[model samples]
Target: MAFGIFDFLSLIGALGLFIFGMKVMSDSIQKVAGNKLREILEAMTSNRLLGVLTGVLITTMVQSSSATTVMVVSFVNAGLLSLIQSIGVIMGANVGTTVTGWLISQLGLGKFSIASMCLPIIAIGFPMMFSSREKLKLWGEVLLGFAILFLGLNFMKEAVGGLQNEELLSFVKNVDYAGQPYIKQFFIVLLFVAIGTVLTIVVQSSSAAMALTLVMCNEGWISFPLAAAIILGENIGTTITANLAALIGNVHAKRAARAHFVFNVFGVLWMLAVFPFFVNLIAGASVDIFGADPMKTATGIPAALALFHTSFNILNLLILVGFVGFIAKVVIKMVPSRSEDDEVFSLDYIGSGMMETPELSILEARKEVVKFADIVRRAFKYVPRLVTEMDEKKLRYYTDQLEKYEDITDRMELEISSYLSKAAKGELSSNGGHQVRSMLNIANYLERIGDIYLEISRNLTMRKKKKAYFTQEMRDRVAEIAALVKKSLDLMVENLEAYERDIDFAKAEELENEIDETYKRLRKEYIKKVESGKFQVRSGVYYSDLISELERIGDHVLGVTESLKKDNELIVEE
Candidate 1:
C-alpha cells in the first residue's frame, strides 16, 4: 500500500492537534500559576545555581521549554533578569524539557496506553470547566489538555504505523546506517540533525516536535541514533522560538535570546563530536534497564530515546554551566546595544506581544510606564532650553525636539494603554489588575505633562514671533518656577523607580505645595508689574502662561505619585 496524500494530511493534522493541546495545557498552567511565578521571579537573585533551578521549576510547571525561554526574554526585556541570570535559567530549561520525552515514553507509548483513558479523563474535566471559580476552570482546562495531548499522540502512532508498507520500508532501509562505515554514519547523523532542526522550526514548538519524533521512533519509522540526532537538532531549533519572540524586544532581550541559541548550538557541536560514544552509552544503559538492545528492535527504542534526550541535556548543562558567563559575553557581542537615538520611538519593556503569564506582562507594562516618565522628564529639559536658547538654529532644534517628544508621548500612552487593556483581559491576579489601573493613570498623567511642555514651547514660540521679549526679571521668575517644576518631575520619576512602599509621597506633596505657592506669588507680582506698566502686556501674558503651564505640569506629576500610592494601598489591602 502506498502512503497517499490523505495519509500525509492525517499525519499533519495529528501533529497540529498535539501542538494545540500542548498550547492549551501550557497556557492554562501559566494562568493558574501566574502570581506565584511572578513572586518566584521577583525573589530570584544573582545566584546562578538558583537561576538554573528556577528555570527547571518553571518549565516543569508549564510543560514547555519554549514558554520558559520566551518568559525569560520578556523578563530580560523588562530589565527584570540580567543576561547572566537568564543564561543559567535557559540551561536549566534545556534539562527540564527532557521530562516530556520521558513522559511520552512511559505513559503514551508504554505497555498500558494512557490514550485509552483519554475520553474518561475528558468526562471528568468537562464539567469542571463550567466552574465559577477561576482556579477550578483553569484546572479543568489543564486536565482536558492532558487528555487531548495523549489522544493526539495515539493518533500519530496509528498514522505512522501505516508507513510500514513496502515502499516506505525500502526508503528506511536505504537510510539505515546500522552496518554502514563509521564515517558514513556520522554524515547520516548530520543529515538527520538538519531534518530535526527544520521539523522543529516548522512546528514552532520543540515539545510538539519531540512528541512527533517519539511517535515516529515507537512506530519503527527511524532508528534510535537518528532519533537522538533529531533531538539534538530540536535543541537548536528550540532557540528559534525565543529569538523570534525577541524580534520586537529591546537589546537585552535580543541578547538573552541569542544566548539561548549560542548555548544550545555549542552543546550540539560538542555532542556531535562524541555522538557515537554517547549513543553506545545510552544503548548500554537501556540494555541494563530493559534487557533489550534498542539498536536491534523498535520495542525498546522509545525508552532509549528518552534516556538519550535526558542524558544529552544533563551532560550539556554540566559541561557548559561553568561557562555561562562566557556564553553571555558571546551573545552580548553578537547582539550589541543600539544608541539611544535609535531607540527614541521604541518601547523598551512591553513589545507588541503579550506574555503567557499575565502578571509578568503587567510587570513589563509597568517598566514601560517608568520609561515613559523618564522620556517626559527629558522632554521637560528641552522646554527650559527653548526658553533660554537665543540662536535661531538652536531654538528651532529644541522646538522640533519638543514637538517630536510630544508625539512620542502620545504614542507611548496609546501603546501602553492598549497593552494594559489586553493584559487585563487575561487571567490577572488582584494585584495585577490594580497595577494595570495604576499604570494607565500614570501613563495618562505623563502624557499630559508632555503636553504641558509642548504648550509652554508653543507659548514661547509665539513670544518669539511677536518680538515680545522677557525682561531679565521676567525670565528669572519663569526660570525659578521652571526649576521647581523640574524638581517635581525628577521626584515623580524617582517614585516610579522605587518600590511602592518606598515612594516618598511626602516629598512629592511638598514639591507640589511649593510650586503652587510659587505660582501664586509670581502671578501676584506679575499683576503689579502689568498694573504699573513696568512690563509690556504681550511679554507679561506670555510669561504668565509659561509659569501656569509649568504649574500644571507639577499638578500632573503629583497626580502620578497619587496613583502610585493608591495602587500600593490596594495591593496591601489585597
Candidate 2:
C-alpha cells in the first residue's frame, strides 16, 4: 500500500471539489426553490400522514434530509409546525435520505462513459454564475456544482481502478479480523455509528458522511455488507441534528427533536431485524447489476449507486408512513412538553432552521412581526398604565422589550428582503414566485408599522418626562384619540393577514378617509380654540405635537394598507 504523489493529490483534490460542489448545488437549489421549500414544509398541521408525505416530498426534492430536518427543527422552535406533525416528516426524511445511497448504488461510477462527459458543464457553468442577474448566476452555479460533483466521483472511481489489479486487489480482499465474534462486530458497528454521528454533527451535513462511505466502498476497504451496516448507522446518527437544535426549544419543539430521534431509531431497529436477509438480497441483486463475474467491473454506470440510495429510501418511506402516530406518541412520552412550558412561539412550532428556506423564512419572519406588533400594542396598553406614573423600572422593562422587538422587526425586514431577492433569482412559477415577492413587501410594511408605534412610545415618554398634561376638555379628546390610534393600528395588523385571503381595498380606504377627515377637523378646531386663548400655550403646544404624531400614525396605517397592492412590484426594482 505505497502512497504515490498522484494518488495523494487526487484524493485531496477530489474531496475539496466534492465539498465545494455540494455547497454550490445546495445554495442554487435553495434559491431556485427559495421559500417554496418552507411552504411545502409549513402546511403540515397535526396530521401525521400529511407530515409524513410532506417530509418525503421535501427531502427528495431538496436532496438532503438533514437540511430538511434541520429546517423542521427551526420551524418547531418558531411555533410553525407541531412536534406530532414534524415526527412524521422526520420519518419520511429518513426514507428520503436513503435515496442518496440508492443514487450512488445505481450510478456505480465504474468506467469511461457519460460520467466523464459532464466536465464541460462545469466549464460553462462557473462563468454564467458570475452574471449580474441573480437568476443566471444561480443557474450557472447549480450546473457547475453538479458537473464538479460527478467529476469528483469519476476521479475517486478512477483512482481506485488502479487498485483493482490482482496484487492490490488481493491485499484489500484478504482483509479479515479472524478472531472477531458477533459481539465484536456489534461493537465495531457501534463504533462506526459513533464516528458517523460525530462527523455528521460536526460537519452538519450527512452528504459528507455518505461521500466518505462511497469512497470507502470504492476502495474495497470495507465490503458492501460492512459499508451497508455503516450506512445504516449513519442514518440513525443524523437525527442528532434536530435533537441538538431543540435544546432551548419549548415542549412541542423538544418533542420535534425527540420525534426526529425516535423516528430514526425506529428505522434502525427495523433494519437491524432484517439485516442479514436484506444484505443477502442486495448481494444477489448486486451481481445482476454489475454482472455475475466477480472480477467484472461495471464502473461506467455511476447512476446505479444513486438508484440504490433512492430505492432504499423509497421502500422505507412506504413501509413507515402509516406508523407515524405511534412514533409521535413515543416522542411525546419521552419529552412531554406542556403548554405552560416556556413556549417561544406556539407549543412546538419554532424550529431554528425556520430561517433556512426563503418561503418559510418569510412566514416565520411574519409570525415574528405579528408578535412584535402585539408588543407594540401592549406598549400602548402600557400607556393607560402610565396614568399613575407607575414604577419607572417596570415601565422601562416593558418599553425596552417593545423596542427590542422593533429592532428585531428591522432585522427581519433586511433578512426577508434579501432572502426574497435570492429566491427570485431561482426557478419559480408565475404565482409562486410572485408570492415570494409579496411576502417581502409585507415584511417591509409591517416593519414600518413597528417603527411608527415605537415612535409613539417615544412621544409618550417625552410627554411624561416634560410633565405635560392635557386640560380637562383636552384630556377627554386625548383618550378618545388614543382609542382611535389603537383601533387604527389593530386594523392595519388584522388587514395585513386579511387582504391575502380576500381583498377589501374599499373598506381600508374608507378607514383611512375617515381618520384623515377627523384629524383635519380636530386640528382646525383645536387651533381656533387655542388662538382664542381658551387654553395655555403649554397645553396648546403639547396638544399640537400630540395631535400631529397621532395624525402621522394614521398616515402610516394608510401607507401600510396601500402597500399591499404594490407588494409584488416592490422587490423586483431594487
Candidate 3:
C-alpha cells in the first residue's frame, strides 16, 4: 500500500489523540492531588537527593518529564524551590520519563496488548467521571485518559503498519551502518540524533516522539542504534519546554531552565563520545533480560529501546548528580541578575503563561499576592513622608513616588485577579477554588489600601496648596495615626505570609481597634481646636480627611486578614 495523504493525516490525528490523553491524565491527577503535591514539593526539595526522588515520583505519576521540568521552573520563579533544589528535580525527571517508554514497550507493543482492553477500561471509567466526589471524578478522568492514550498508540501502530512496505521507507531500510567506517557511523548516529530532536520539538512531547521512534523501529524502518540516537536527541529536546516557559519568568527562573538545558546537553555530549559502546552494552543487556537481540529482530526493538532509554538517563544522572551545584553555577554565570531596582514594576512570582498545573499556578499567584502586600506596605511609608516634608522638590518627589506606587498596586491587582480568574476556570479542588476567591478578595483590599495612601498624599498636597500649614500638635497627631496604620499594614503582611492555620488575626484585630479609637479621639480634638481658633479651619479639614483615610486603610487591612481567615474556614468545611 502507498503512504498517501490520508495515512499521514491519520498519523497526525493519532498523535493528537495521544497528546490529549496525556494532558487529560496529567491534569486530572494534578487536580486530585494538588495540595498534597504542593506540600510534597515544598518539603522534599530541601536536599538534592530527596529532590531527585520527588522529581522521579512526580514525573512517573504524571508520565511527562516536560510537565515536571516546567513545574520546577515555575516553582523556582515563585521562590518556592531554590535553583540548586530544582536542578536535582530536573535530573530525576529525566529518569522518571523513561517510565513511559517502558509502559509502551511492555503494555502497548508487548505480546499481550493493553490496547485491546482500552475499551473495557473506558467503560469502567465513564460512569465515575460524573461522581459528585472530586477525587472520584478526577480518577475517572485518569482512567479515561490512560485508555485513550493506548488507543491512540494502537491507532498509531496501525497507521505505521500500513506504510511498512511503502517505497517511502525504502531509503530508511537501505541505510545500513553495520559495515560503515567508525567516523562515518559516528556521523550517521549524529544525523539520527538530530532527527529525533526535531521530531520531539515538533510534537512538543518527548513521550509522543519516543512512541513514534519505537513504532518505527518495531516496523523495521529504523535500526536499534538509530532509535537509540533519537532517544538521546529527545532528551535534549525535552528541555525546550522549560526554557520556553522561563522566557516570561524572573532571573532565577531563567537560570533554572538554563540549568536543565545545560545538564541535558552535557549528558548528550558525553554519551555521544561513547555512543557505540553504550549501544552495545544496552543490546547485551536486552538479550540477557528479554532473551531477544534488538540488533537482529524487530520484535525485540521496543524492549531494547526502553531499556536503553532508562539506563542512559540513570547513568547520566549518576555521572552528573554530584555536579548539580557546578551546573547551577554555570547557568547562574550564563544568566546574571539585573539590578533589584529594575524589577520594581515587574511581577516577582507569577509569569505571563499558565506553564504548570493549576495547583502550581495557584502557588505562583499566592507568592505574587505576598509581593503585592509588601508593595502596599512600602507605598504606605511614602504617605508619612509626604505629610511631613517641607522642601517643595522633596515633597514633589515623594508625591510622584506615591503616584507610581498606586499605579503599581492597580496593575498588580488586575494581573493577579486575572490570573486567579483563569485558574478558577481550570479543574480545581474545592479548597483551591476557595483559595482563589480569597486571593481575589485580598488583592482588591490591598489595592484599596493603596488608593487610600494616594488619597492621603493628595490631602497633604492640597493642604500645602491652600497654605493650610499644620501646627506641631496637628503634625504629631497625624504621625501618631500614621504609625498605627503602619503597624496594621505590617501585621496584614505577616498574616498573608503565614500558613492559614498559623495566621494570628489577634494582633491585626487589635491594631484595627487601636486605629479606630485613635481616629475618633483625633477627630474630636481637631474639631475642638478649629472651634477654639487654635487651628485653621482649612488645615483642620485636611487633617480630618487624612485621619479618615487612615482609618479606612485600617479597615482594608483588616479585610485582607479576614478574607484569608474565611478562605481557611471554607477549605476546612470542604
Give candidates' CA RMSD values in order: 11.5, 11.9, 12.6
User: Of 2 and 3, which scores higher on TM-score?
Assistant: 3
TM-score per prediction, in order, is 0.68, 0.58, 0.66
Candidates arranged by TM-score, highest first: 1, 3, 2
Which 10 residues in a row give candidate 2 its minimum summed lDDT?
A: 293-302
| Residues forming the 10-long window of minimal summed lDDT in candidate 1 | 339-348
Residue-by-residue lDDT tens digits, candidate 1, 330-400: 98789876755324555667755678888989989888898899888877877878777799998987787
| Model 3 misplaced regions, further than 4 Å | 341-574
Task: Flag the better candidate by TM-score, 1 or 3.
Answer: 1
For candidate 3, give the lDDT. Answer: 0.87
Name the candidate, 2 or 3, with the larger lDDT value. Answer: 3
The lDDT for every candidate, in the order shown, is 0.87, 0.63, 0.87
Put down candidate 2 lDDT per residue, 45-93, tens digits, no spaces.
5666777778777777667887788788887766567666777788777
> What is the lDDT, from 0 to 100, of the residue 502 in candidate 1?
77
Task: For residues 1-574, write the lDDT of model 3, one tens digit per residue.
Answer: 7899999999999989988888888889888887877767766534779889989999998898988999988877655677888899999999999999999999989888899899999999999999999889999999999999999998999899888778977877778887899899999989888998899999999999999888888888898998999999999888899999999777888988999999988988999999989999999999999999999998899999999999989999999999988998899789987744223565667644673678889999999999899888877878888777899998997887777678778878987998898888899988888889999999999998878877877878888989998888988998999999989888888888994657888888899999999999998988888889998888888888888998999999999999998998787777
